[model samples]
Target: MQWDGISEFVYVAENESFTRASKKMAISTAQVSRQVSALEKRLNIKLFYRTTRKVSLTEEGRVFYQHCRSVLDGLDAAEHAITNLHSKPQGKIKLTAPVTYGEQQVLPLVNNFISQYSDIEVSAYLSNRNIDLVDEGYDLAIRLGKLSDSTMMAKKLGKRTSYVCASPRYLEKHGVPHALSELSQHSCLLGTLDYWHFSELEREKSIRVSGRLRYNSGFSLTDAALKGLGIVQLPDYYVEQHIKNGELISLLDSYRAPDEGIWAVYPQNRHLSPKIRLLVDYLAEKLR
Candidate 1:
């Protein structure tokens, strides 16, 4: 089987235009058409449905394209690994993390990493949304809490615990809740999640919370809590310093859930890049 035909076919499928594919592959239009035709003839199937205006993949073409894409991805990974085998970590690393954590922790570490490895560049996207690492072309991501994607590889960076807290003024105005059930009596400043984490006799629990003011940002929720609007459940990074400064008082300590693991997640590619591996290690060490 000729590899050129497969490459041409994939490129054509992606662009949906023979001319565009030819340009992208730096080959003539005749060459691109010849290779794709050769592939279809060899496979004994129609790969594309062509009209005067556009090209569309046939059902068979779509199936073939999926397999071809995976093959091309593997080939690219192999080439990347081979090229960087002995080289210092160089090139751009695209990473994503939750906005608050990125600004508070990951950004500083990434700054330090670039300072140490002068050849490497970093691009970070701080978002609360769970980004598709492969589709988004990200090298790695820093994920907090539990990981649900079994397909990705995760390295534990450290642990973060949730803090249920309120300002002294709020506690004084509204008597502190003594137990989980008592949370219903006091207004709870809700964050993005619908439930607040807790622990009961070694078992993790999530209690549904409500508030007069609901916010998606931890900073906003903490600020609301500071102004005595309501109680808030937040990660330690947002509330720890305030707890020390007597701006916020930790509540329901006995029911505080087990610490959640912070992870550096990446695609489970066969050849993980050195830049990603080393950065994950650096973050783990610094966070620990």
Candidate 2:
């Protein structure tokens, strides 16, 4: 079969609108319509049910779309492999990470990666929100805790340990919590999550914690703890130095939760690009 307008047909089918597909593919709406018309004529089928404001694909169109998408994806993988063979890592690698971790850990490594591989460019988005890597076209993402989305492939860069800490003054005034249950009597400073993680009798445990103050930023929660507002649970990186400086005290050592993984996640594709693979490796080494 002729493949002249197959790409346009695929785009329209996926997007469910010629106008939106045209905008995405940077073509005119009329051109997109023309290409789809040509494709339908060649295939000799009614592909779409057009309406005044919407378009719906026919059953036959849906089946054809799946095959076309697979073919295009294969072609893209082959192109990526062929074009980048024996070539230096070059092209923009779009990445995302949590704001605190990105600022404290990932950003420095990313900068060094770019320094070493000058040909590889990076665009990083730092936020706490869960980003859809495939839909957003991210090359990779630095994710903390457990991997929830099974669709993405992940490499463990390192582990992050949560610390229950309080300022020396706060502990002195409110008394230290020797056991997990004692937390209920003490004022707690909370982050984004309402529960805190711990371990009991060699098994994982979670306790619902409440606080007068709650914020999304780890830095803010640590700050509140420092001012003797309440006890807070934060990652080791955020409070280790303070604990060492005798400004904060680490408590509940026996009950500290199992270390959670720090991961570099990317979509599962047939071909993983060298730039992404190398970057993940670099982060794993640097973080370890």
Candidate 3:
């Protein structure tokens, strides 16, 4: 059987829908159906039990699927190895990160890297939603906070310290909060993480703070705080320039927020491309 047929079969089995498999493979649905049919004809057995709503593998199909998936995976590894041997890194590298961080931080570094390496092409997806790197064929991702994905390798770039702050005008109007308990009396601008934590003395403490406005985007909340709407807790990178310019002021100096780490993550099994490795190292150096 053609290797292409085997690959298509594996995709179909994993997705359980010819239409979905076709989209992923970048082929027509009819082509996917025909390849599976031809494979079934050659094997002289039904591979899939198909209904109008769903498709499931038959007994023979289950055994064939395991072997097909292994073969396809091995073929991908071989291709990556062959590409790496050519000396120059050349190919598309797909990456993802949070919207604001990707725009303000990752894009500049990516531009510098792309300028130096003309052969390497890069595509970046900026969203907060967690992406499946292997399943979606992404080369790598930049993630913040704690990582729980055991299947991927995480290279931590550095840690970002968060600050609680507000504009001088807002502080003058509402008065500065002397302690964590007094936050309830102020008009706080909350972000995705509602519960704030701080390192006091030798221990870390956390408290859930509510506000009149809650925003999903850190950029939005920072903007509100800049306009003297309310106090906001945000990363240092997001507010450092503003604070320096006297547009915002830091508060609760004695209590330090827990530091969040940034990481470069990729699937564990795939060969690390020279281009991706260089970019990751470059970012770690620049961010540090």
TM-score of each: 0.71, 0.73, 0.70
Local lDDT at 69 for model 2: 71
List, residue by residue over 131-236, the lDDT tens digit for candidate 1: 9886577889899988999768888999998899999999999999989999999999987677898999999888998879878788898899999998999999
- Which has the better TM-score: candidate 2, or candidate 3? 2
Q: How well does candidate 3 score on lDDT at residue 185?
A: 91
Over 11-51, each residue of candidate 3 has an lDDT whose tens digit, in order, gives: 78877899989998899999999989988988889999999
1 against 2, candidate with superior lDDT? 1
Count of backbone collisions in candidate 2: 0
Q: Where does model 3 exceed 4 Å of error?
A: 1-86
> Which portions of model 1 miss their true places by more than 4 Å?
1-86
**Candidate achieving higher TM-score, 1 or 3:** 1
| CA shift of 247, model 3, Å | 1.2
Error of 1 at 74 (Å): 13
Q: Candidate 1 at residue 116, lDDT? A: 95
Residues 1-288, model 2: lDDT tens digits:
677787888778766789878986898999999988988898899889999898888999889987887787788788988888888887889999999899999999899889999888899999888898866878888999988997677889999888999998998888989988999998899877889999999999999988799998788888999999999999988999999999999999999999999999887542468888889999999998
lDDT of each: 0.89, 0.88, 0.87
